[model samples]
Target: MSIPHGAASAAARPDRVDPAVRRIGATLVVGALGVVFDTTVVSVALDDLAKAFDAPLATVQWVSTGYLLAVFVTIPLAVWAQARFGGRRLWIAALGGFLLGSVLSALAWNATSLIVFRVVQGLAGGIMMPLMATLLMQAARGSHPGRVMAIITVPTALGPILGPVLGGLVLHLADWRWMFFVNIPFCVVGGWLALRNLPDDRPEPGGPRGRLDVVGLLLLCPGVAALVYGLSRVEGGAGTTGAAVLVPLLGGLALVGGFTARSLTRPGGALIDLRLFRHRAVASSAALLFLGGIALYGPMMLLPLYFQQVRGEDALGAGLALIPQGVGALLARALAGRYMDRVGPRRVAVTAFALVAVATVPFAFVTAGTGGAVLMAALFVRGIALGAAMIAPMGAAYVGLRHQEIPDAGVITRVAQQIGGSVGIALLAVVLQHAAAGAHGPSALAGAFDRAFWWSAVLTALAVPLCLLLPGRPEPPPPARTTRTGEAVDPRRPTV
Candidate 1:
C-alpha cells in the first residue's frame, strides 16, 4: 500500500506524533469529556436533586449510584462490543446514547426516572472510556505511547478541575437540568468529529469476529458492580459489618473468582484475555494503577471534606480551593510524557509516586488552623506528582502489546484503576469514621482527618517500589524504510 505524504513525514520524525493519532486522540477527548465531567458534575448537585424531586437523600443517591453501577456492569463489555462493531460505529453510537440519556435526565420527573436515565448514560459512557484508550492505542501502533497517553488523559485531568466548578456555577446560576444539558455539546461535537476524522476499520463481513462470551459477561459484570456497590456502601458510613456491605462484597468476590477460573480454562475465548497478565508490562502496570488509584482518589475524598468541615468552605469554595491541585496536574502532563518517552515509565513512575507520598505528608499534620496558602502549596505538589504517576503506568501498559491486544489491555487497566478507587474511598471512609467517632469539635475532626491522610500517604508510598516492575527505558524504533518511489514508511504502523 502507498504511504500517505503525512504518514511518511510522521514516520521520518520519530519525536512528533502522527497527524492521524492526534486527530483520533482529539476526537476521543471531546466525547470523553462529557463522561468524565458528568461523573464529578452530578456529585455536587445531589442535595439540589434531592430537594427538586422531593425524595429522600438515600433514594436520590441512586442517581449517582445507579450510574456508577451501570458503568461497572458495562465496562467489561467494551472489548467485546468494539470487536463486534467497528470502533467508529461504536464511538458514534455510544456518544448518541449518552446524549439521549443526558436529555432524558434533564427532563426526569422523579428520582427513579433520573436514576434510570443516568444508567443509560453510564452504559454508554462505560464503553467509551475504555474504548477511547483502545482505539488510540491501536491507531498509535506502538509509537510515542507517552505522548499519546498524555493526550488521552486530558479529559480526565480536566474533569476534577473543571467539573465541580462548572457544577457549582450551574447550581448557583441556573436550574439543575443544565448539568445534563452541558453534556449535549460535547456529545454532538465529538460525534461529528469521529465521523469526519476516524478511519472506518470495521471487520469485513463474514470475517472471524469473536463471539460474545455470555457466561463470562454474566459472571464478571454483576460481580464488579456488586463489588463497587459494596464499597460505595462503606463510603456512605454503613460500616463493613453490615449485611448491606458484606453480602455484596462476598458475592462479588466469589463471582469474580469464578470468572477468573473460567477465563484461565478458556483463555482464547474469554471476555478478556487472561494471558495478557503474563506480560510484565501489562501486569505491573495494572498493579501500579490500582495503587495509583488509591493514592489519587483516597485523598480526593478527604481533601474536599477537609476544606468543608475543618476550613468552613462551602461546596463551591471547596471546589475552588482544589484548583491548585488541578493546575499542578495539567502542568505535569507534558513533562511526564516527555520523560516517559525518554527514560521509560519505571523512573518516571517511581519518582512520581515518591513525590506523591512526600507531598501527602503535609496533610497528615493538617489542623483547622492550618494556613490556606500552605495547604494549597502542598496540594499543588501532590497534583503534579499524581499526574505523572498516572501517566507513566497507563502508557507503560501498552508497551510490547500487539495491535489486537490493545483493547483487552485497555479494559484491564481501566477496571483495575476504578476498582482501586472504590476500595480507596471505602477504606478511607471507614478509617475517618473510626478516627472521628464522637468528635466534638473541628479540632477533633481535624485530628481524625490527619489520621486518614496518614493512611493515604502510607498507601501511596507502597506503590513506589512497585513502580520498578514497570518496563524500563523503551528501545528506539527501527529506522523507517523507503519504497522504490523513495517514500519513507513505518513497517510497524497498522493500517486503520
Candidate 2:
C-alpha cells in the first residue's frame, strides 16, 4: 500500500527492519566507492598505458573506450539479471568479475591483451555501479529516499573529486599496473559487506520473467558502442574522418531505432521499459542529463590538458591544480541535496547551469601568464556548479517513478549519462585538437583552447531550458492499492 504523507511505508517500518537502515546505507556507500574509483583511475593512466605497451595513443585509448562500450552494452540487462538471479547473487558476481579483471589487467603483456582485459573489467564494473543504487533504494523501501540517495551518491560524487588525484599519486610513485591493483581492497570489502548486510528477497515471480531478449540486446549494445567508437575515432584521428564518423553513428541509430520498435510490440520482456519515457519529468530530465554531461565532461577532458599543454605542468601538477574544482564540487553536494528536497530540482538545475556558464567563461580567455590563484578560483566555482548540475538532473529523473520501477529508471539515467560523457569527451577532444592544430607555440595553443571553451559555455547555456520540465515540487506518493504485491495485477500495466 502507498505510504501516507510524511509517514513511513512497510519497507521502513521500525519493527520490520532486520537490524537498522543506516547499516545498510554503509554497505552501499562502500560498494559504490570501489566501482566509481575504478572507472576514473584508468582515465588518468592512459598515457602511461600507451608508453608501457609501446602502442599509439589511439590504440591505448581502447583500454578505456572498450570498457565504456562494455558498460553501455551490459546496462540494459541488469533488471533481467536481477529477475533471473537474486540481487545479492548478481551483486556479488559483479564485484567478483571486476576483481578478476583488475588482476588480469595488471599482468597483461600487450595493448591488445590489455584492451580485452579492460572490457571484462568494464562489464563487471558496469553492473556494480547501478546495483549500488538498486539494492540500497530497494532496501530503504520508499522511506527516506532522500537519505538513501545521499548515501549511495557520496562515492559517486567523490569519483570526480578524488579519482584524478589518486590516479596521479599512484602514477608518480609506482607503475601503471598499480592503478588496477588499487581496486582489489574495495572489491574484497564490498563483497563481504554485501553478503553480510543485504536482504534475501527473490524477484517477484510473476513479473517479466522468461526468455532473454537476445535480439533487443544485439541491436542496442552494438548500436550504442559503434556510435561512441565512431565519435572517439574522430577525436583521435579528424576532416572526412570526422564527417565519416557519422557512418557507424547512423548505423547505430538505425539499430537502436529497430530495437526500440521491436521492444514496444513484444510482451513485458522488452529489453528496456520504453513506457517510462511517458513521464514528462523522466524524459526532460534525461535530455538535460545528455546535455549537462556534454558540458561537464567536455571541460573535464580539457582542464587537465590545458594545465599540461598551456601551463607546462607535469601530470601530477596538473592533477594537483585541478583539486580546487573537486573540492568545490564535494562541498556543494550536501547543500544541493537539501535544496533539491525543499525547493525542487528545476530551479536548482537551472541556476546551476547558469553558474556553470559564468564560471567557465574565465577559461575562454586563459593565458600563459594567467594567475594560478585566479584560475583556481574559477575552477572552484565551476565545481560547485558541477555538483549541482550532476545531482539535480538525477534527482529530477526519478521524481515520479514508483519503487519497483526505480531499478529500471536507474539503468536508463546511468546509460544516458555515460553515453553522453563518451560523446562530450570525443567532441571536445576533436574541437581542442583542431583548434590547437591552427596554432604553434604556447600562446597559440592558449588561443585555440579559448575557442573550444567558448563552445562549452554555449552548450552549458543550452541546458537551461530543459530544466523547466522537471516536476515543480514533490507530489504526494501514489495510493495504497497500486503498491501492494502478490495480487492478480497485469504485468503489462503501469505501476503508478
Candidate 3:
C-alpha cells in the first residue's frame, strides 16, 4: 500500500470516482441487489408461504434458515475458487447458479422443495457476496477506500429498507412466486454486464493454479453452518436453554473452535487465513463489523413488528414506515466517503456510530401514542448514521492491504458481519419473546420493542471505541511502473 510522497493526494479525486470503478461498482451492485433484496423481501412473506404450502409456521421458516446455512457452507470456498477460475468467470457462474435457483424456487410445489431450491440460491449467493467485495476492492487497489466502499455498500443500505417493501407488495398482490421472479432481471442484466465488463484475470499460461484447502474447508464451512443454524433457532423463538438453542449453538461453537485451531496450525494460506487478524486495522474492523451488524440489523426485526403489531400497520405499511431510514442511508454515501477520505475512518466511524446510538434512543422511548412523524424523523437520521457507520469500517478493512490480499479480507469481513447480524437478531428475538410472553396489548408489545432498542443502542456504543483502531488515512497510490516503451504500461490488471 506504499505510495510515492509526491503523488497527488486522494482528496484531489474526491468527486471524481474512477470511470472503471464506477462501471465495476454498478455491475456488482446490480447483481447483488437480487441477493440483498431477496433476503429482506422473502422475510415478509414467511407467513404467506406457510399458508400457501399448508405447512406449520415452524416448518415454513426453514426456507430462510436453510438458505442461510447453505450460504455459510460455501463462503469459505470463495478464495480458492476465484484463484482457480478467475473473478470474472466465477461471478458469471455464481450469478447463473442464483438465476437457476431463483427460477426453480418460484416453481417449487411444496415447502420442502422451496427450501431446497433456496439452499441452491444461497450457495451461489454466499460466493457472490464475498467475491463482489474482493473484485471491487482489489480493482480499486486501496487507492480510494472511502469512495470505493461507498459504492460497494449501496446494496447493503438499500436491502433492509426496500426488501420488505417489495416483499410486502408481492405478498399483497401476487403469489409468493413473484418474489423469486423479481430477481430474474437483476441476474440476467448483472451477468450480461459482467461478461462484458469484468477483467479476465486468469492465471498466466502454464502458471500454477492453487489447490482447494480441503481440510480447512471441511472444518470451517460446517463450523459456520452450525453457528448459523444455532442462531436461526433463536429466531425461531426458542428459549436460551431449549434444545433448539443449545444443540446447534454448542455444536457450532465446538466446530468453530476446531476450525480455529486447525487454521492456526496450517502454514500460510489456510482456507481463510486467520493470521489476517494480527493486523490492527483488520482485526479491529472485524470486531466492529460484528457489533455493527447487530446494531444495524437487530432493530430491523423489531421495527417492522412494532409497527405491525402495536401501531396496527399492515406489512406494506410497516415497510413504508422504514423508507426514511433507507433514504437517509442512500443520501449519506457522498458525504461519508468524502469526510472519510479527508478526516480518516476513525473520526468518521466514531461520529457515525455515535449518531446510531443517538438515533436509536428515540425508539427506546417510544410509546403506543408516539407521533408517527417524530418516529419517522428519527428513522431517517438512524439510516444516515448506519449508512456511514457501515461504510467507514468496511473501507478501513482494506486500507493497507495489497491487491492480492483483498479476497481474504473480503471473506473475513463478510463472515463477521453475517454472523454478527444473526447474533443480534437472535438476541433481540429472545428478549422480545420473553418480554412479551403472556402480555396481550399494544402497550406490552411496545415495552418489548423499547428494551430491544436499548440493547441495539448499547451494542452500537460498544463499537465506537473500536473505530479508533481503523487506519488513519487512505494511502497514496503506488508509484507507477512503465514498460520499455515510453508509454505507461498497463496496470497489473484492469478493474472493471
Q: Give the candidate number with the greatest lDDT.
A: 1
Regions more than 4 Å wrong, model 3: 1-15, 489-496
> What is the alpha-carbon lDDT of model 3 when measured against the actual structure?
0.86
Model 2 per-residue lDDT tens digits across residues 363-467 = 999998899999999999998888888878777767656766777777777778777777788877877888888688889999989988998998889998888
What's the candidate order when arranged by decreasing lDDT?
A: 1, 3, 2
Give residue 11's lDDT in candidate 3 (0 to 100): 34
User: What is candidate 3's lDDT per residue for 1-496, written digit by digit as tens?
Assistant: 2121222322345346667667888999999999989877888898999999999989989898888898889888899999888888899999999999999999999999999999999999999998998888776656668888999899988998889999988888998899999999999999999877777777666877788888788878888898888888888877778998889888888888888998878887678888878888899899989998999888999999999999999999999999999999999998898888878899999999999999999999988999999999999999999999999989888876767778999999999999999999999998888888887889888888888889889988999888888888655554555556643322433433
Q: lDDT of each structure?
A: 0.90, 0.77, 0.86
Which window of 10 residues has the lowest lDDT sum in candidate 3?
1-10
Between 1 and 2, whose lDDT is larger?
1
Supply every candidate's count of residue pairs whose N, Cα or C atoms clash at under 3 angstroms: 0, 1, 0
State TM-scores per candidate.
0.97, 0.89, 0.95
Best by TM-score: 1
By TM-score rank, best first, the candidates go 1, 3, 2
Quote the lDDT for 25 in model 3: 88
